[model samples]
Target: MKILVCIKQVPDMESRFRPNGEKTWYDESDLAFRMNEYDEYAVEQAVQLKEQLGGEPEITVLSIGPERTVEAIKKALAMGGDRAVHIRDDRYYQKDPWQIASMIASYAKGEGFDLIFTGMQSQDRGSAQVGVIVAELLGVSCATTLVGFSYDGGTITVKRELEGGIKGVAKLKLPALVTCQLGLNTPRYPTLPNIMKAKKKEIASLTAAELTGEAELTATAAIYPPAKKGGGLVLEGEIGAQVDRLMGILKEKTAVLR
Candidate 1:
């Protein structure tokens, strides 16, 4: 069983982020990058699947980003993917969901992959939409919020997380797309030995412009995330008065104050 895992490199959320001078993008100078948090879980799922399948199932890690993204791929390799492919292009810095999905789908077609995996969302953007869009472009079935799975021959059973503590069990044929959720499995840390091994693994580089003749990416305007709101309000007053004022505030916020 061959599996392809789409990973993403993102600015580490732990770093202090500042907006660009025009407030159009993040300040890159002081930022540290890492594998997108959700994608790390996706990588973990792929590794676990390979371990259970009793053979390393040709797990290829894919990413679209700048040259620095190689670091992210190396992390996945240190965790145990068979190989890594990076789509290098400056446009990836400005790629929207549609562009990213189209590019990935174009590359995956005819790759003869049995399964495709992605993290549920990228932490920096948190749009949570690309995996489905890519699956659509690839003309394959996709399931998201996956928590667990069981494979039987060519049939794959997956556990999907739903609303209010509900979970749905689904079965899909081979060559399906899965967006992994946290709690699927624990991601492994790279030991010093594996880190050394990763340094010797070859990372293949491909350019987005050369990737199977997909449509040129649409231009997008850069926009940084809105500044986070400050800490919550702390109400203080006599108990009864506090309750009444809290009710009034809540009502006003909910537009039920009338």
Candidate 2:
């Protein structure tokens, strides 16, 4: 069996972010980069599937970004991916969902991968379209936001998370795609030996132009943080007084009471 896991390098959420000169995305110069948090669950699920199948599958971790993405790929390798492919794109942040998905689908086409795994969405962009778009472009079945997964070498069964704490079950044959969600599995920390071994693993590099000629379907006019709002009003006194004050404020400030 063959499995392809797609991942991305994103700025650590804790780091301070500033808009770039173009104001299209966050500046990368002073930011610390790490693998997208959601992709870690995808990688863990892939590794667990390999173990469940007696370690016969070839797991290839793929990422599209600038050279800094090599670090994220290495981390996936340490977590049990056999090899990696890096699709280099210096202006990756500028690409819209269509362009990004096109590049991934272009490379994945005819690759004979039995399964493809990706995160439900990226942390930075949070546009949860790439995996499903890749599946559509490849003409395969797809399921998103998977919380549970099982495979029997011929078909895969997954439990998808729906709104309102509901789960929808789905089954897909070979050559399918799935986008993993959080709590699907516990990600393991890479040990020292595995980290060392990952440094020697093979990583094939390619350029975005080499993969696809798709043009951007959307453009960002601007990006900025939300405007600050005033502090909340505190109600002080007994329960009845607090309720009366709340009702008075609502009637005065909003149309809800009317």
Highest-TM-score candidate: 2
What lDDT tens digits, residue by residue, belong to model 1 across residues 21-87? 7555677787888888888888888888888888759899999988889999999999988888899
Cα misplacement distance, residue 58 of candidate 1 (Å): 0.7
Clashes (N, CA, C under 3 Å) per candidate: 0, 0
Which number leads on lDDT?
Answer: 2
Off by over 4 Å in 2: 233-258
Clash count (model 2, backbone only): 0
Q: Rate the local accuracy (lDDT) of all candidates.
A: 0.84, 0.94
lDDT of 2 by residue, 1-258 (tens): 989999999999998888899899998898999999999999999999999989999999999999999999999999999999999999988899999999998898978888999999999899999999999999989999999999985999999999999999988998899999999999999999999999999999999989888888899999888776876987888999999999999999999896
Candidate 1 lDDT for residue 214: 48
For model 2, the local distance difference test gives 0.94
TM-score of each: 0.82, 0.89
